[model samples]
Target: MNYIASITSQGQLTIPKPIRDKYSLHNRAKAIIKDTGTIIEIRPLPHRDILSLMGILHDNPVVKANRGKPSQQIIDEESAAFEKAITDNVVKEMGLPPRKK
Candidate 1:
């Protein structure tokens, strides 16, 4: 489908909904836009899942050690909930079917 879009004064152009849907570019998806001399190219960046964040906190000794924590259990529970939220968000953003419990 060919679409003619107007660029705003802010130099921003809205990608048509059909194209966004086709490329799974919803929910603030990142993309690479470049002028290839002959043609302009727009490609959606790869989507990362929660598992990819593993070891992200390793460098943060305070958080990694879990030291000076009074309620480790509560922290663990909240972390689990946060992980679930991240997973759910990724699924929703990618327009994938919800995971079964």
Candidate 2:
């Protein structure tokens, strides 16, 4: 499936209709871009709501170890931890005040 797409002035390229239709990529579909040294790849991500992702890690060994807790709780905790790390990094980089404990 060789398709050519021209990049616009703003560095955006439109995926041709045939490829979009084949991948079910309708309006506002999200695509993940990756660069693997020699090649770049674009992959369409399935549209799913947060609720749809619940229990996705239910059978995982790590999640199973904390069986009593809900999966959403674990997700929330991890999300908070990630956000904190990002905030801390930005604060350090910008010489901002340390975040209150």
Question: What overall lDDT, based on C-alpha atoms, would model 2 receive against the true structure?
Answer: 0.90
Question: Which candidate comes out best when scored by TM-score?
Answer: 2
**Where does candidate 2 clash, by residue pair?**
none
List the candidate 2 regions with Cα displacement exceeding 4 Å.
49-101
Clashing pairs in 1: none
TM-score of 1: 0.48
lDDT of each: 0.86, 0.90
Model 1 spans > 4 angstroms off? 49-51, 54-101
Question: Which ten residues in a row are the worst by lDDT in model 1?
Answer: 61-70
- How does each model score on TM-score? 0.48, 0.50
lDDT of 1 by residue, 1-101 (tens): 69988899999889999999898999878898999999988899878866779989878976766646668775887799899999999999999999998
